[model samples]
Target: MVGVLERLERLRAAADLVAGRIPDALAGKVDDVLARSNRRLAVGPQTVVALAGATGSGKSSLFNALTGTRLAEQGPRRPTTATTLAASFTATNADLLDFLGVPRRHEVAPPEPDMTDLVLLDLPDHDSTATAHREEVDRLVRVVDQFVWVLDPQKYADAALHQRYLRPLAEHREVITVVLNQADRLTAVELSQCLAHIRRLLDDDGLTGVPLLATSAVTGEGVADLRRHLSRLAAGKRAASARLAADVTVLAAELDRHVGPARGSGADRRVVDDLTRRLAGAAGVPVVVDAVRDSVRHRGTLATGWPVVSWLAKLRPDPLQRLGLGRRPELESPGLRHSSLPARSAAAHSQLSSALRAVTAELGEDLPGPWRDAVAAGVREAEPTLGDRLDRAIVETELPAERSPAWWTLVRVIQWLLIAVVVVGLGWLTLNAVLGYFGLGVLPMFPLGPEDGLRVPVPTLLVAGGVVAGLLVSGLSRLVISAAAGAAARRARKRLEYAVAEVAEERVLAPARAEVARHDAARAALDRLR
Candidate 1:
């Protein structure tokens, strides 16, 4: 009983996961089964065994023989029973009878303890010409805890019976029985042949191992054996549990066809990586990385270049700041500041879409239709906000701008010293020229070297060497700045990619993985039912 309840709970959970996703027909059928099982379970522990058959099959006669009373109307008419009639040894199963919708009920005198637990039902002919009669049979067939298919010798192999009931209910063989009614009419040899033939037909209908009995409601032949079978089932008091369990198992199997097998593991890592890469591109990470490098070089050159010309570098705008990115903003801002980066080109957008589709396909390849659709829907739903999310990531990221290399400061100091030397040399030269021009006393000037035999004044050499050295230092500073900027760009790229990956996980991968998880859970529940 514990196993039975557990299986039913699993089936219910599995059904909930795919409630509106599967075919409407299957979903409706399962819901009906669940509803009926719940009502039956709540009713009581009485084992409601139904006697079902076609017209003139003596189903009602056998019902009377089993109960040892003529509760159900039995006659030679083509269709004697149009409504379901239930007979129990005790009158306490009114709720159970009400649930079964059998208004015509009768109570027999107290019987043996085994018989007291049984609620026997006599049902209408399954192949009746009247629709209501057939409907009643179908309804009672689903709700009953056990079935005794009564067959006369003439229609023992009825195609309608096998096609309509036995084959469709092959999963409930444990709770089903076949009784060859009116066996007294057949000689021993004929009975043996007929039983053998019926067994073969039942086997063909996948009803192997279902109990077969030869009963005569008129002569009471094989009636005691039928009673003993019902008595044992009633004594065990597991017929209701077994019947409901089988119903759940069959419904779960039907649902399994729509859910497919459990996924071996979580979403594929490669698919997630590919999705993140695509999202990064769409979010403009590459563009931001390039801007970071360019911004770094622009700032570095201004810091380290010769003071006389360093102001020229400042004239150009910082690439990152121009984009409204590269720096963190106030925490209270509603939305992150938009970047000046250009919108993605049509080709880039197309590539991003293709990548998203690839991820969807990879994740949903082996999933059932409903689950695959769920995954695709999740990806598409997340796509609309991807651009904004990427922008937010960029706004929140910290660029390498606040700190400068010590080398820039050292070079700036050296360049300033060289400018000072040039300034001093020019001042000395100007003084001498002015004094000589005014006919005042000429200042003594030192000649450090001679170029082509012409004496070169020390002051003139200082001015010329300082100007030339400053140019060389400026050129070297450009190279250093380029290298530093390249490193900064690589670091920025890593940070941006990490941010993009987080967004991908939150918006895209998370939803897709959730669908997969539901699929896995549903499949696991189906396994328990099996």
Candidate 2:
């Protein structure tokens, strides 16, 4: 039980939402309907019915007969009734007449008791040669509450009238009545055939069940019945609201074409994931992951490598530092600084474009052409900023920290101790060789291999064992560092993938989804109006 006002509001909301996104002509038509409906409703409850017809159709005659006055002039010229004229059966119709812009107004003399609160307007011919006359007819036709189309036997089926007015206004069947005005010219058989033919034509125009009357203004044929119908319409005081409702209904139907049934939820997870993968590639996720891995390896080598060669590792650049990554500058400051990652290649851009199209197509699968194009256009409009957003995402992403493990410190101490033993063994052997060469006694030899077996020097054992243990410890530390590097790379990939997903959501998918939501909202409102 929605009221006419509620339906009108729904139509207004839908039109506003879909205005620019739809075609210009349709948007303009919706605006016109809203304007005319609001104005007609604002003017009181007086029923303003117009006698509308083509040139020489006896519309003025029908008007005079219906109002019981000669307020309109009838003529045999090619085109008559150059301006709109109105006859008010009640005294309180000035507001409606002013709203209709019909200045030449007349009060019915000896008004019929039955035609109370009726304002019968005899509008200029819709087919007038003068542009002003036709414009006036067009303007009044849109705002009038009801229409009594005064047609003659000859031009009743005229294409100019049916195509231009009747077919288009089929939605207003409840507020429209067709009159065969000049029916005296036809015999009874011809009139019946003419009425049947006109009925068929009305039915073709989707105006079936509309009141059709054969009235001769000159012979007063069926004029009383037309008057009674007008009296009933005027007494009900619902014509204005009904006309507005019909207008809203027609407009809502037209706007509904731009939308369709909602498909799946606006987001397609598969398409989104694919887009994220493409975007991650474009954002240099792999490069950053590799950098993380290399950075970890470089730091570990510097911390645990033999001291003699560890300084050489420092000469090579830190991979994370070279990329200006490894730190979240965005968090420390206001804006993100760009990373030194390589620019996206042309192939990457092409892949990104295809991914964006896929996203739009998936979301807009159920939309009409105009709305689908609208969704695409909205997404494309954000493309220029997408690169910057992605760069920001990469810069803001946190990589694995380059903290040294505790085992590296122990490894370093063990290597130094081994080197010290080697140094002491070399010094002792140098002292013994010098003493033997100078004819002084050598220091006492402490080591013999098994008591009765071949003996080995203590200095020789000390140097060889120290060197082998140091090599083994260094080799084991490297294997641990390699495993840690792989772990760091995996962690970096996870972080970068999350950041790229955010960029995809904010830059591409969000806008496309919003367009889909807009289409759904407009469709829902139009359905409620229906």
Candidate 3:
């Protein structure tokens, strides 16, 4: 058998797990059970059995007769027991009585050795016209371990008794006993008939297994049997545990209704991937990748292009720099930084919202309505920060830089040598022309075969060959840079996507998964209560 402390611990653990997720009303009920259980545990080894019944049921009279004291006043008034009155055979149950709020206490002689641990309470009428009287009954009923429902023959089958009290506590059948009090008013046959009808009514109320007995405070009929039953319960020392276990069982069933069937193992990787992709789009990851590629190509062209037009490349803005993306390693700051990436279009925003909804729906598919709502709320709570987090991620990421190719250096040197050749040739031709103009001797010049046997000018050939060679080198370098930049762009895109996926995991998926995990844990705990 599970001990009271173990059972109470389980109830407390389960309640803590679902503290904020469950409905307030249900949470309040669970809290009440915990509070009552704590008080019972503090009382220690005392059996709190309450005398509960409808108005004019002779419950107070039976209470007085059971304890052999007139602790509770029995009278002609409809609601005679206005407050709770307690009679304990044990003297050290003051804390328990205080916790129950029963101000009136009566000391009673121990009737039997087995009944020494009993603490009896005379509670107000269950169907009292005065709200305070009914409230007292409601409050004491929850705190008591066993209920000796002292019903009169007239009001034994009252709907208020069965429907309001007995039916709801059907799980506590083991701890409940129904008494046909005032039995002296009936003859032998009438009393039998009334007992039979009461049994049938209890059966309908789902209290069929609960014990039933006939007692009379006036005639003292069946009172000893009631006492013997209470003695057995008091001696067993199981009433507290039984009552708590029953309370846990009922609460577990109620909580179980809010949980759905278990989902098998493994995380939903596909949903996470899809959400990452959509968020990457919304976060302008592709734009950053494209910027990296363009910046790489531009830098390459400036390094290896024809020196004549390289100045024009320098005049244009660097693609990565325009987006605040590719700064020198030493210049970057260690703080959250935003990219100059443009705002997402209306369609992109819509796509992102749809993706979020889709993920929430898939994750919450089998969850109860409240849990599903919680999941959605969690996603919504994380959404506003997503864009900023992604931006920070993009800034933090080490993107591919516009690294210059090794051949650019060699090509640049060759181009400068060619330009030197052109300049030397031009100077030679100019000197020769100056000399010819003054009728001085002309300098020797390299000859080249030309059409119609006319020698081509050496100076002209040198300048033309140099310019063409430089142009050819620039064109070849452009092709190689373009290809390398395309590969770098692909790599950059993967890196940015990976960073965005991390943000999605932390900001969105983590909370949702935590909720699912809580649900699973709560379900498992409730199963243990069964």
Clash number for candidate 2 = 0
- The whole-model lDDT of each prediction reads 0.85, 0.85, 0.85
- Give per-residue CA lDDT, model 1, range 355-403, as digits (tens): 8898788878899888899999998998898888888877777777546
The CA lDDT at 105 in model 1 is: 84
| Candidate 3 structure quality by residue, lDDT tens digits, 124-169 | 8888899999988888777788999988877777777888899999
Q: Report the lDDT tens digits of candidate 2 across residue range 1-530.
A: 78788987888898877867788998888888778777778888888899999888999888888877777888877666888888887675677788889899888752457577788888999998899998998888888999999899888999989999999999999999999989999999999999999999999999999999989889999999898899889889999999988888887777766666755436768999999999998888898899999998888888777766677998998998788777543457525477788889999999999998998888878688877887798789878988888877877776774566788888989999988888888888999999999999999878768889988788877788788888788778889999999998999899889999987887787778788788788878788889
Candidates sorted by TM-score, best first: 1, 3, 2
Which regions of candidate 1 deviate over 4 angstroms? 265-274, 328-334, 424-466
Clashes of each: 0, 0, 0
Candidate 3, residue 211: CA error in Å?
Answer: 1.3
Better structure of 1 and 3 per TM-score: 1
Q: Evaluate model 2: give its lDDT.
A: 0.85
